[model samples]
Target: MEQLNNTFVAVQAASRQLALLNSKQINNILVAVADAIMEQSLFLLAENEKDLTRMDKADPKFDRLMLTEERLKGIATDMRNVAELPSPLGKVLKENIRPNGIRLKKISVPFGVIGIIYEARPNVSFDVFSLCLKSGNACVLKGGSDADFSNRAIISVIHSVLKKFDTDPHIVELLPADRQATSELLHAVGYVDLIIPRGSSNLINFVRQNASIPVIETGAGICHTYFDEYGDTTKGAAIINNAKTRRVSVCNALDCLIIDEKRLNDLPLLCEKLKKNNVIIYADAKAYRALQSSYPAELLHPATTESFGTEFLSYAMAVKTIKSMDAALEHIQTYGSKHSECIITEDKSRAELFTKVVDAACVYTNVSTAFTDGAQFGLGAEIGISTQKLHARGPMGLEEITSYKWIIEGDGQIRK
Candidate 1:
């Protein structure tokens, strides 16, 4: 057991050493990974189809978690973008010369080896590897068991690319496919610099409770969109429609809507647009009557405060009417998961103030909540949208996996 533990520790130490590489080398590895992702697109799609053969396209769980042609194309485009972004590591953080001839500098560095445990989406396998490598962090991935074949295939292709990049192919690795391997991985928490959990709340919460290693909690976008009194009904209608309807199962899609009490009358027009996009609305008592009279019961669902935290991940939404901005914010604080929130308001003061106050990873003004993505933020690719407030707050791109260390160069300087 002692010798085995030593091997585990070495894996982590090696991963960290590789993460300290210079910017140019890191960029070269990312470029190679991106090229590999594009090259293996067809193989990836075929493997995903095998997985999908067991799943239903219309199934919400399958829909939220499957790989498709468009998604693969999107992934390819994103990896190219990640390859284009400037390498984030090795930037001199600070430089100061001491009177005693000591030059101290803090520099951006990789977090060594990152342990990523995610669920059901195979495309993420490529994205996570790309981001971690670009930021000079080696990663150990454990994807959802449902995607076992796809995960292994993607990792193999990535490793092939790494050989040509002149980097340690082991920089990116995968965890054992066996279910028992997770317990072993968690116990080796000392072997990983940071652990990132991306999946359902149950999975993320499970890792948080069991792992002693540092973990970045993510996923659970029971987010919201507030329509102020001055909301452009046209814009509000369009934005919310696009958000809830465009991709119902994504993390940043709108789950709730808060309309100003003064503008409660707009609910009719709003519901009209939302329903046209095939959205099912869950409304409060006040919004219920307006919706109840305007639409059939099939188009609405009755929800209490408890429903506020629901991330339906379907063509469904919850609508609320509050008296003030404070009231709206309070509701979100009460039930939100701090993922993403947006406000549609013509008033700049209200928009700015709301943006300042909302405690979320991604907050938006007068736009769709679903725009909270790494690509939308123009970073090329995203590993995940982190819900954790520490270390990283929003999209975990190639730049988010690194840490910094103080580098001190002294000429015979001694501590007094």
Candidate 2:
């Protein structure tokens, strides 16, 4: 408890100094960190392998936990991209002078110290650090036990870079991978300005329910892609296949496929690509009959009521057959996690309606839900995809992590 408290205090203190750094200084540290990651890729991967050996290869989190050389290179590239982007701090959001000679300006500022609790994904260590530092907020990371070895190795590399630049290493702290550490972080009220949980719905819910500090809910993508009667089979198949199988462990991966009942004949064609990937299909009665002739008999099953709202996080998907666009919308609204949703249609009006009406961070028209990413969205990289409609509701970039302050200047005019 004492050690965790000390970590919190040090991070909170360091945040003040971090926020005072000029953009060039911050950018230089980021660039050096990126260079160091590439330099030590082999060592990082070796440590990651230690964590991987402990888990079953078939676990959905195995993919997320495992880190490769190519993935390290990608992580390095994203850090460099963050370095090139302008800092989110000190931007003037609004400025005005009142009749009482009081000039007020709303300027972007850091959240001070942020606490992030995530599971399995060690890459999140680098991502959250770069984003928090770029946005002028210090972060305390609580990575899951599943990625303990990996997270430790990654944080060591980051600390080395921070020390090389003469910056306080406490600016980014990684807590012990234990339940006790999690308890401490959740209750660090004054020390942590915000707590963002990035992982499964269970993890996010635990943090939201327990944290004494402000919480920003992220992760848990029960995404859906709707196929309208007007949808082109070729386009729909390609889009759905890519969205579902491109990276099943990711948050944007599709979990449900809503098909217009009028397009039942097109279902087999729409699901043809999925067969090559050996995807498991859990279909409702209507969709079951439509896919029985085409999909693999072994991989196909009748979907239970629980299948519709599930975040599979695996090579499995639920299919629901609907009679109209309204039915499609209703099904999505009832089951979607509001992370990402897509509609593949040649009809312009239907596409527009889907894009406008679907409540999600990223709503797509004839595009794959796989595009719901920070780097892909051109925000350099993201802390996470925010699903709630609050301060942030999409790919949370540097700007999303920051808060604003009201700066007031007086001209010595006192009212009687």
Candidate 3:
């Protein structure tokens, strides 16, 4: 508790100063941070490998945890891109002239200190810092224990860049990777402005349930892709393969497949593509019976009730056969995590209806669900893919990280 208090105190003391940084100053620091990251790639990779070697290669998080030269370059590119973007602060969203001779302006501003509790992905340390800095907010990062070494190295690089600019490094502080400190951080309502959890469903739910600070939940992705009766089997197969197998460990990877009952015979095309990549299918009884004759027994298994909503962060997906588009929609509403959902259909009206009716952060038509990302959306980087719709939804970019302040100018008027 004392440790967390000290960290929060440092951030609270520095938050105002951070918010005062002009766009040019913030951009310059971010550019320097990007250069520093690229320059120190050897050191960063060495530190990352240390953490990677301790974990099993078969683990899904390994892909997210390991940072290669290409990924490092990509990270550097993201930082530069963030620097080039327009500043989020000081944008006047609304201006009003009141009858009492008062001018009211609602301007965007930082959220002070944002506390983020995430797991495994060390790149988030840099991504969050860049977004927070670009938006003029201080951040207190609490990374999972697995990436301790990598995160330490990354933060060291970031702080060094901050020091070079004569800015207080406390603006991007990292909390101790322990449960006790995390507990204190969760309840530090006065110090932390908002909390965002960006990892497993269990972690997100834990923070949502326990935190005294306001939270924007980034729920786990039990994403789904439905193939309508009129959809092209070949194109649907390609979309499903890319969405499901492109990067299975990530949040946007497809977890469930919904096929029209009329197109049940075309299942082999999709199953063949999945089997080519060695993906195992956990199918509902209807889907299982339909697929049993063609797909190998090892590749097909009966899905239990528990499989419907599960986020299998692996090369595995749950399959279901639906009678109609409505049935598919109902099944998704019941089981989806509201993260990302897609529809593969040739009929324009059906695709439009699916997009309109499906309540998700990202709804797709004739496309893969894997494109649900901040960087992919050209927002540079993201805090996380928010599932809830209060403050921010979808990929939380710079604007999403900001809040508005109403500035009222009056000579001698008061609220009557």
Candidate 4:
């Protein structure tokens, strides 16, 4: 407990120094870190392979855990992009002169120290660090045991870059990959300003229920896409195929397909590409009958009540048939995880309605839910896709990680 407390205290202390660094200095550090990642890509991959060998290749998280040279390059590119973006700190959100000779200004500031507890995805270590550094916030990472080797390697590279710049490496600390460390970080109330958990629903729930600090829920994407009666079969097929198979382990990957009852005839054609990819389909009665002749018997199964709301994180999806647009909306409301939802329709009114009424962070019209990403949305890179609607609602980037403070200046005005 004492060692964990010391780590937290050091991180909190280093945050003040990190916040004082000018934007140029921070950006230079970020660029250096990105370059360092690329330089040590081979080492990072070897360490990642060590972790990968312990897990089954069939596990969905295996894809997320495994890192290739291409992926490392992408991570580096994201870091460079973050460096190129404008800093969110010190921005004046509001300013006013009071009647009592006092001036007030609300300016953006860092959250002091952010504690992130995530599972399996080692890339998150690099991502959260880049975002927190760019936004002038210190971060304490609690990575799961599944990717401990990878996270350690990534953190070492980051520390080397920080040392090269004469910056305190404790500004970004990685806690031990153990349950005790997680407990310590969660209870570091005075030290950590916020806790963001990015992983499965169970993990997010555990953090939310257990953490003493403020929590921001992310990950666990039970996303859905509605194929309206007026949806183009070709476009719907292409969109569903890309969203499901592009990268099944991602949070934005579609899990449920809502089909307008009138569009049942188009279901088979819409799912043709999915069949080619060998995606398993869990269909309700109506959809099952519709797909009976077209879809492969081995890949098709009757969806249980539990299927609709599941985040497969694999080559699998649930199909629900709705009688009307209202039914589709109701279905989505019942099962959607509020992460991302999409509608493919030729009718503009229906599209507009879906975009407006669907309770999701990201609502799409004729596009894949896979576009719900921080970098893809032009925010450089995201810390996570927040499902909660309080401080943050969607992709958490630099600005999302920051909080604001009211600075008041008085000219010898005393209150009665």
Colliding pairs, model 2: none
The order by descending lDDT is: 4, 2, 3, 1
Candidates in order have lDDT scores of 0.80, 0.94, 0.92, 0.94
Off by over 4 Å in 3: 414-416
What is candidate 2's lDDT per residue for 176-276, written digit by digit as tens?
99999999999998899999999999999999999899999995999999999999998898999999999999999999999989999999998999999
TM-score for all models, in order of appearance: 0.92, 0.99, 0.97, 0.99
Instruction: Tell me the tens digit of each residue's lDDT in model 1 across 126-183.
Output: 7887787778777778777777778888888887877776666677777766656666
Q: Which consecutive 10 residues in model 2 have the weakest lDDT in total?
A: 407-416
Q: Model 3, 1-416: lDDT tens per residue?
A: 67678889999998988867888999999899989988999999999999999899989899899999999999999999999999888999999999889999999988989999999999999999999999988999999889999999999999998888999999988888899878998999799999999999889999999999999999999999999999998889899999999999999999999999898888887777888778889998788888889888888889988889989889999999999999999999999999999999999999999999999999999999999999999999999999998988899999999999999998988887
lDDT of 4: 0.94
Name model 2 segments beyond 4 Å from true.
none
The deviation in Å at residue 8 for candidate 4 is 0.6
Ten contiguous residues minimizing lDDT sum, candidate 4: 328-337
Per-residue CA lDDT of model 4 for 1-416, tens digit only, reads 89999999999999999967999999999899889998999899999999999999999999999999999999999999999999899999999998887999999999999999999999999999999999999999999999999999999999998998999999999999999999999899889999999999999999999999999999589999999989999999999999999999999999999999998999999999998889999999999999999999999999999998899999999999989989989988988889999999999999999899999899999999999999999999999999998999899999999999999999788899
How much is 308 displaced in model 3, in angstroms? Answer: 1.3
How big is the RMSD of model 3?
A: 1.4
